[model samples]
Target: MVAQLMRSELPVLIEHFHLPTLPIDPDDVAFILCADNGKATHLVSYDNHLLELDDRYQFRICRTVEFLQDPRVSQAR
Candidate 1:
């Protein structure tokens, strides 16, 4: 599954994120940092730390189901 994901077109790899990022959990910061640094359109997660931050940054946070249900999401894909 991981290999397949690496081959997928939706996800992109980022080299690094500049400092002075969010103040949330250091462990979970990567996810937010990735979205922030990449200027992502959407962030999908089951974690509350990230979900609660829907409007806090450039991206919109939602679950897998919500993402799939959105017409805009399909168009983006």
Candidate 2:
């Protein structure tokens, strides 16, 4: 799946992006790094480690339902 995705134009092939320094877990940082590198307007996740953040980044982070119900989320979609 990863090989196929990398071959497509999914924009998952981030090269020189720098990861953000968050107090959360290291693995969670990867999620943030990807979103940041992709210049995403939002960061949606189920992990408490990512959701419980102090809302530090310019991007917004929320759970599944929170993201779904948010009218603002439509802009992202």
lDDT of each: 0.74, 0.71
Task: Give the alpha carbon lDDT tens digit for every residue of 1-77 in model 1.
Answer: 77887778566555465644453655677887777778877789888877867766767789999989878889977
The reply for model 1, stretches above 4 Å from the true place, is 1-23
| TM-scores for candidates 1 onward, in order | 0.62, 0.61
Among all windows of 10 consecutive residues in model 2, the one with the lowest summed lDDT is 12-21
Off by over 4 Å in 2: 1-21, 75-77
Candidate 2, 1-77: lDDT as tens digits: 98998788686633443544473576676788777778876788878888777377767788777778878777767
By TM-score, the best candidate is 1
The numbered model that scores best in lDDT is 1
Note the residue pairs that clash in candidate 1. none
